[model samples]
Target: MSSLLRIVRFTRSLAPLYTAIIIASVLTSVAALAVPFLIGHATDTVAGALAGETPTGTAVRAVVLIAAAVLLAEIANTVISNVGGWFGDVMSNRMRTILSVRYYDKLLHLPQRWFDSEITGTIVARLNRSITEVTNFMKMMSNSFASMLITTLAVLTISAWYAWPLTVLLLIVFPVYVWLTSLTSVKWQKLEAQKNEQVDIASGRFAEVVGQIRVVKSFVRERGELEDFSRRFRSTDATTRAQSSHWHRMDVIRRAFLNLVFFAIYVIIFVRTVQGAFTLGEMVLLIQLMTMAKAPVESMSWVIDSAQRAIAGSRDYFRVMETPVDPRTAAMMAARPEGSRDGEADGAAGSAAALVRSVPGAPVVAFRGVDFAYEDGEDVLRGIDFELARGEKIALVSESGGGKSTIVNLLLGLYEPSAGSIEVAGHPSAEVPLDQLRSRIGVVFQDASLFSGTIAENIAYGRPEASEQEIVEAARRANADAFIRRFAGGYEQVIGERGLKLSGGQRQRIAVARAMLKDAPVLVLDEATSALDTKAEIQVQKGLDELMAGRTSLIIAHRLSTIAEVDRIITLRDGVIDEIGSPAQLAASGGIYAQLLDLQSSGDTRRLARYDITA
Candidate 1:
């Protein structure tokens, strides 16, 4: 079903509450109708009493009782509308919460290729609008829609009972009113959709400019950036203005039509009264009922328009919701292995495979003859094979785009290999549960994306259950404790967004501390020390050395210095392994490694000496 119909159907599911409110609301309308009827009856009777007919006590008594009934009806109307609004809000909030959680769950289970294909801003846009759209729909349904439907039904029923011909005339005109309203809605919905698309485009441009603000300022490209953003902003504003015009035009047309319709109703009623078909008192009742109905009829057109816009907004969100998630059933056998004595299990993996990894003894991560390509013919990784034993430390060194980070992501099961299979501890990577797999691994990235939060919270990010003392210990391990203590509130100090309040080195060290606190059996250090200062780099390297001592580790590095100390170096070029050997062995081979050592060692041509990494 279409989203508009679905929203309405879902609303109907809360029929018990709404039906009760509607029943009360209709009764209130009936009582209100009686007030005008009583006045008409009293008017006709007073004329009779004045014309020397016996004074009718019953008519006076009827008028007094109807007045009391009108007072009661006003209270009932208020009570019903408020209760309906509360129930609708409750249901809307429930739906929003459910959808929000499902989105995150689906996100984690999605294959790496899917995430790589979509922009981050687009995903954000889907989520941010879901709750807003649901809330808007609730307000429209229970408030504007409920009142109009009840009042409209009441008016038509009363008119039919008193004057069948007039009722039929009014009923016939409603269909035309509805058709015109739909026309306005169609025009407005197109504009609304266009406006939403423009916002997404503008947001993407803003994200790019702000993300690269440092480079823009340092290279004096701020003016160019501003110009690019201005161009995007102009497009956004143009679409917004066009959409605004459509809505305003619709508002004017709908209101004018309702007014014209109202005039026609009155002209018909007046002519009938002059012909003596109805008394003067009956004419007054007709005028009073129509007067009360003008608001709902006019407002109904706008409600229909809003319903269309809400449906358009919900389309993207529901599509994301409907996307399938990976079952990962094949990996279940290795998902959770029983811990052996001393928390170490026997592994079929090699010695260098175990360092800086999460799962002990048995390999927590591996890539076996893994081959990949963005497309069918263009292979990126050719039969790549590796295994991380429970506590092995390994480094991948290569030129730019050499597939070092790709290997790291494969271990994380972000992407499945196209030609070969990868297993985490002898199980197919795709078979393991996503959250469990992630919880077993921790990563320290080059850029070190830190959020605005307390130093303690940042340090304990991976392990939110970490105690205050544990957070402090992890910070001390990365040489971050001294600087953190210097902050005004120490662990309580809040870092600005993306940790802008902290130095680059400080943020990098804190990120390392977070990984350390996780105490995962696997660690992916992707250029972890590439962004730090010399002193901070030394401190971070020391922490990494300790972190790698007993877990599987994969280091993706551009800097030649970081690769010299690994148990073995896997050198890559153009996504293929160039050579794999110890630093001494590769240097002796006098191939790629020897040439690299020659360039990075002093300005001399001789047997190379490795840098003394004090950290």
Candidate 2:
């Protein structure tokens, strides 16, 4: 009931359309009732004329009037039906648009944790199915129920005027129908909920298989995947059958009981007519009224069915919208630190020296005693503290699970620290609005994810409003301009999904170009060149150097060669900084950095020896 009310409240703007629909439907239904009465009157007058009890001219006029009324009723029904249909379609589409926008907006604000835990397929299926059901429910309520209710009432009122006994019996039967509907509705809702869950499971499986087709092919698991999907489909089909059977049984029972009562009413009216208490025309009127009453009673089942599905879908949809949003996305926009230039912390061209010159010794980013843990998981970071001075280049080198990426996640405001705090440009990271903070930082990840679009479009993703000249300059700076121009369509060449049409190094350079276009004050490269061959790495490394030149940069790399020239190196172990110094200082100190360097050199030597033997 609450969900239904919520849907109504959401569509309050459509109240005028609803009013128009109901008014047209009521008029149409009222006009239709007059047809039966018109026929009854014509019958009695024609019978009297045939029996010589009435004038033939008067009977002809009555027949003509009845025909005209029937014609007018049919025309009115058509026009009103059209009007009501138009209102319903417009209302359904409008509600769909409103709900779709709200669903996406809520997703943007919802906690990242929810995204991590939920299945993409299931979420999308629920979103689409629920909106459809909700729209259908609203349409039926306006177009069908309005007419049904009005017809039922108008018929009953006319019956009462003719004979009170028949009307009273009908009024008594109406409550039984209502009571039966109420009794079955709860069970119907429960069945629908279960059916929907089965659909969600099947949807999730289909999405998973399609998205990972390559992996399945590589593993030769196509047969297994098909079997799994078939099993889920069978389960969904079974649930659907159960739901349908329950609905059919309830409908059958409701119809049988109503028909029995209607037969009893018919018998009473027939006997009354036979005893001369009612005329043949009056008997016909009673029968017509009974038929009209029966229609709405039967229609009650359909209305409730749509209502149940809608209510169930709405409950799930509302759950998502009502979930708590990520705190970072919810943060209000904050002012730039006092005395900082408008583009000082926002431009990639702003060199570290310029930043230090403006505010000496102040860090562009700082983390103080930060600690973090995943839900029900071990601590990933503990009492970790670090700072990147304005205009300085730093590298974080660590084994897997050393909390390097965790720090980046915290700095980006993707997650909150369990304890302590992080500051960016003298403002708390948690306090700065997420979009504003991210706009000031550029990141190039190892995987280099891309959508299916032209090279220019992908490059301009970070700053969609970037001018052509700006795009060209950024591409040139990232060393991607030359290769992009070689394509048949130049920058307009369509890249396949995730830029899979391009080589790994080409994709990486495109990602770098995107970051270059963003031109943020801070840059983070997470193993950006680690996945490339030697030749590719050399090419991508140059682009990285150009991108990092003027910004305060943080490089996360397992390859020691990549971090050799950074201003400082921070080595992490077991969720805390194990060493921090310049590369030369750490090497001379014979610390973790020096040992790792020697180990890599030894491994390279063995690789060369093996290559010589193969040659």
**lDDT, candidates in the order shown:** 0.69, 0.80
lDDT of 1 by residue, 318-421 (tens): 56655644554123222332210111111211122212223345565667788988745587788787666666667786656668788877777676678778
What is candidate 1's CA lDDT for residue 194?
74
User: What is the C-alpha RMSD, rounded to one decimal, of candidate 2?
Assistant: 6.8
In candidate 2, where is summed lDDT lowest over 10 consecutive residues? 341-350
Cα lDDT, model 1, residue 439? 68
Models 1 onward score TM values of: 0.83, 0.90
The local distance difference test score of model 1 is: 0.69
Q: Give residue 29's lDDT in candidate 1 (0 to 100).
A: 58
Against the hidden true structure, what lDDT does model 2 obtain? 0.80
- Runs of candidate 2 with Cα error greater than 4 angstroms are 331-361, 604-615
* Residue 49, candidate 1: C-alpha displacement in angstroms: 5.7
